[model samples]
Target: MLFFVALLVDGILAGSVYALVALAFVVVYRVSRVINFSLGEWVTFAARLVGTGTHALALPLAGALAFASAGMAALALAFNHVVLHRLIGHPPISLVMVTIGFGAVLQASTVLFFPAGSGAISLPVPSEPIEIGGLFLVPGKLVAAAIAGLGVLIVARVYRTRTGLALRAIADDPQAAMASGIDIDRHVVLTWSMAGVIAVVAGTLSAAVWGGGLSLVLVGLKVFPIVVVGGMDSVAGTVVGALLIGVLESEAAGYLNPVLGAGFSSLAPYLVLLGVLLVRPYGLFGTPGIERI
Candidate 1:
């Protein structure tokens, strides 16, 4: 029982990071209706920026994080202005494909610019392990989880503010919002910028957990299941979905991996995702849309 509890705790800690990444996806989708397939690339880019800033530039950890955040926000704005801006009226499929292509470009750029042999980026947090009544926890993971929780709270609070109301209005009816004198383009840019910043924070926390590198980009792909399971348009659902997936993955890895011969934890999320799709296509908290032909 103690072991089970330990695993559950660990899963929740890990889920906090996943929740942040899924929240980033939700933010962009809510505003622009774009899935932002290139989100993983942005995360990878931010992680690389931090790695570069810390190692090559020899800056303090705080300084490196600040630099990465600013750089990512600028890049997001530039991408929005230069590429996304031109494709505003395009179909959703077109937007998704463009983002996929952008992700490919980012992957190539990361390979070309970052050092081929660069190892893990060190964070400033303590490396000690905390043990309590036979349950052990890593300080870094605890800190990351706390930060992620705090971030979610801040985002939730944002939804109550005037700017968030404007954002919600744009999401509900872009045409009506524009008619009301809301600057859709400007708001879209701001949403993307906010997503970029969130991506940086998520990537940094994830890198601290799994070590920094291009591999961290895969975390972006992992977030899809969380978003899908939670409800694409529901921020609160993201938190619940993250925790559910995290716990299931942890339990599966602990109990089933030996029989399944490993890698079960990674596969568990997609399995849940499939089940959610089959049972509730719109997701647990997603509202089904009604269309008249």
Candidate 2:
């Protein structure tokens, strides 16, 4: 029972990171109306920047992460202004395809620039275990959760900004917002870059636990079920989904893995995704406006 509780706690903390990324997805999709499939590449690019900054260029870790996020945000702005700007009214497929191409560009650049990528690395923080009663906690996971929580708060604050209000209007109807004198290009470019910050945090957390490598890009796949399970358009729903998925995944890996074997642990989230979609196609908190993942 105690072990089960520990697994639950760990999963919830880990899910906080996924929730952060999911919030990014919600933010981007709500305004842009295009699901950027190249999300993984974005994450890898940010992680590579951090890895290169710290290990290769001898910069401090926090500074490296901050610089990486800032650089990525700039890159996102460039992407929106330079590429997506022209395709503003293009079909969704065209926009998605462009994003895919852009992702490929990002991945290729990471390989070319880094050559030898950052290998497995943990954060430069104390790894001491903290015990509360009989429960023990990992400092790394605690820090990750705190960062995720802070990110959620930041996202909430964004929704109440004047810019956010304009963005919301644009999200409701781009054509109408444009007719009403909203600067669609300016707002989108600004908002799109925010995703870069989220991606950096997600990428960095993954690096601290899993390693900073090209494979870190694939971890983006892990976030899919999260946004899907929670409504992709709902920030609050994403948090609930992340926690639900996180705890279930932890339980499956902790207990079921021993009996059902290794692969099942990794498959648990997708399995839940399938189950949820079968029942709620729009997701737990999603509206019926958009249908399709």
Model 1, clash count? 0
Report the alpha-carbon TM-score of model 2 versus the true structure. Answer: 0.90
After superposition, the stretches of candidate 2 with alpha carbons farther than 4 Å from their true spots are 115-121, 290-293
lDDT (tens digit, per residue) of candidate 1 on 1-293: 99899989999999998899888888888888888888788788888888788888888778888888899889888887898778888887888998899999988998899885342565567898989889889989999999999999888888779888889999889889999999988888888888888988888888889877778777788777888888988899899999998898889989999899698888989988899889887788876777999
Where model 1 places Cα greater than 4 Å from the true spot, the runs are 116-119
lDDT of 2 by residue, 15-37 (tens): 88878867767788878877887
- For candidate 2, the lDDT comes to 0.82
Residue pairs clashing in model 2 are: none
- Which candidate should be chosen as best, given lDDT against the real structure? 1
lDDT of 1: 0.85
Error of 2 at 251 (Å): 1.1
Itemize residue pairs with steric clashes in candidate 1: none
Model 2, C-alpha of 44: deviation from truth (Å): 1.6
